[model samples]
Target: MFTPHGPSLRELAVQALSSVERGYDLLAPKFDHTPFRTPDSILQAVERALSALGPFDHGLDLCCGTGAGMGVLRAVCRESVIGVDISAGMLTVGRDQEPRPAEPGPRVAWVRGDALALPFGPVFDLVVSFGAFGHFLPREFPELFGQVHSALRPGGRFAFPLPAPAPPSSPWYWALLGFDTAMRVRNAVWHPPFVMYYRAFRLGDVRRELERAGFDVELYALPEFGSRRDGSPRCRMVVATRRDDSSQRREASHSSLAAS
Candidate 1:
């Protein structure tokens, strides 16, 4: 569902065949006009939810293509905000299009970096990523989560919105399933695979991986998107806070002393 100004079918076909980085680079200029960009409504909903949890000092947006999540960070964080992405082209567009907040806000900066090996220390108080998970394979979850944990200070949060999976009865479910299956087939035959799968990121598995990566995971329902047939939230924000390393070390010491 792209607009008149969005990438054409030919452009999208070329992107799908190229490597993920190259594909995004090719699409970056028109990405906002495509359905691939994070929707404004979703962004506003996330901004509202995160504003309550914040007053943060430094913030980072993981995989911040075109910097859509920068607004959310600026709203919640106090001092400075950075958007990290792998594609230089995307960063260029983001820098060119970045909007200044009406009132004074955090200083905004863009960095070209990979999400798996983020080029940062334990400095950020808040990190938010919007609709970029599909680029990462499920097997990379541990490294990805660990990278985010390492980027955050103790008690810092890594937040992202996850929509509820469509039910089997819904046409949307079938559509997503078909898309993922096709992507798998394409990757199997193609070189420099364009990895974009809609159904691979499951909530249960993600929570477990986050906990293993030293985060206390919590889910906040976004009621603005309403509920499902089972009264479950249609969309939710995953807020994973980095656990205090000192507390963990203390517990480990106690366990070792008990064993002795």
Candidate 2:
């Protein structure tokens, strides 16, 4: 258990043995109380970075979860915002918890849909995701990005914060490495695997995949997170611009998310 309000250890173990969708459904109620929830600091930092780039007309929170990114969208996007996720349970929590804004902002729509088979046209000017990629296997990267490319209008951007990979010398690296190994072993013997591996989604590989998916990618350092000793950012935002070209179609590599 992460806290008194978070899921207990037994609950987590049960969720881990279930399918991804079902697992999230079980955790949906207490998701916000968990350390797994995207922290307010990260969300605020992302909003700060995006505000400089926009007055965006429309935005999508891919794998939206309990609608944390919805606030970010409301701050920057003018007309409307959409949050798409596979878990109905998660969506319910977001819908019921909608904050009454002091001033009315973007029209919020929460849709139940798969990120891989997104139910939208080239409708969004911006797509933002917070802390949701680890649920996907690396093999799904191409198809996942393809969906994001299709969802965005021409010249639209797919933006999400990416924390730098832990260095091999850091304790975090070994911790994540061990966690991933345990997950692999669990899934090997279990039916309906719960996929959550921190190290599996490599940023270097992700950047290459995004380019392949026809995105002109850019990385922006999130100064709020400061920098590593090597002067690289502790966290960076990946801003992948969508381009529509027949030649560029095999390209675009990208999420629908689990809450984390």
Each model's lDDT comes to 0.94, 0.91
lDDT of candidate 2 over 1-260, digit per residue (tens): 78899999999988889998999889999999897889999999999999999989999999999998899999999999999998999999999999988887889899999999999999899999988899889999999999999999989999999999998999999999999999999999999888888887778999999988879999999999899999999999899999867435433221223322
Q: Give a tens-digit lDDT track for model 1, residues 139-198.
A: 999999999999999999999999999999999999999999999999999998998988
Best-fitting candidate, measured by TM-score?
1
Clashing residue pairs in candidate 1, if any? none
TM-score of each: 0.97, 0.93
What are the RMSDs of all candidates, in order?
1.1, 7.1
Compute the lDDT for candidate 2.
0.91
Task: Please state the error at residue 235 of candidate 2 in Å.
Answer: 0.3
